[model samples]
Target: MAGTEGIDITRRNKKPRLLTDAERDQLDEFVDSIHYSSRYNDDHYEYRHVQLPKAMLKKIPKEYFDGGRGTLKLLWEDEWRGLGITQSLGWEHYEVHEPEPHILLFK
Candidate 1:
């Protein structure tokens, strides 16, 4: 959340459908629990993500998932930057990975 000062990171979209207080709270909790790690794989660093709790899948709005299309954007310099929604290439750590209904992972 460091570079999100001017960005509305809580809401799922730029439309009028704002997040409910409870949803916002849940998102905040998820953000708080997020951890980022990098490991040297070959000559490059590979970022890794921790598997999130399954409960988060229910707490967040359905629109946030966007059928695997990212509802969230990357933040940089206090602004939402490019990196528009694209299909995952299977190696990206930030892709929302739900191997099962009970397993959720994101970066």
Candidate 2:
């Protein structure tokens, strides 16, 4: 059999692992650290811009953490709701803002 060289398949098609106790705690703490704020938009409509810090990257899998807006949103939507973040049906929901690689701003 011939050997295949330079064909790395590590972490390919891998699923996110369950967070450990410490990781869970870290995530919780970070979530708690986030502030809930509602500001008026240019149209004078009240909108929220919640910012998620990159601290989560410490424990969360990079595959999911850096997975773009929708992925990031899906990962934290539940937690955000628990923090009193309303949905678009009732009020204006937040939008994912990626101002920098280390920060996630949902405004």
Using lDDT as the measure, the top candidate is 2
lDDT of 1 by residue, 1-107 (tens): 11233333443344434566666665555554444344334233333444334555566556445554443322221111111111233333233333443222222
Residues 1-107, candidate 2, lDDT per residue (tens digit)? Answer: 11123222231224334455665665666675555555545443434555545565454544444343423432333444543334443342233455543333332
Candidate 2 wrongly placed segments (more than 4 Å):
1-23, 61-71, 74-76, 82-94, 101-107
Quote model 1's TM-score. Answer: 0.39
Top TM-score prediction, candidate number: 2
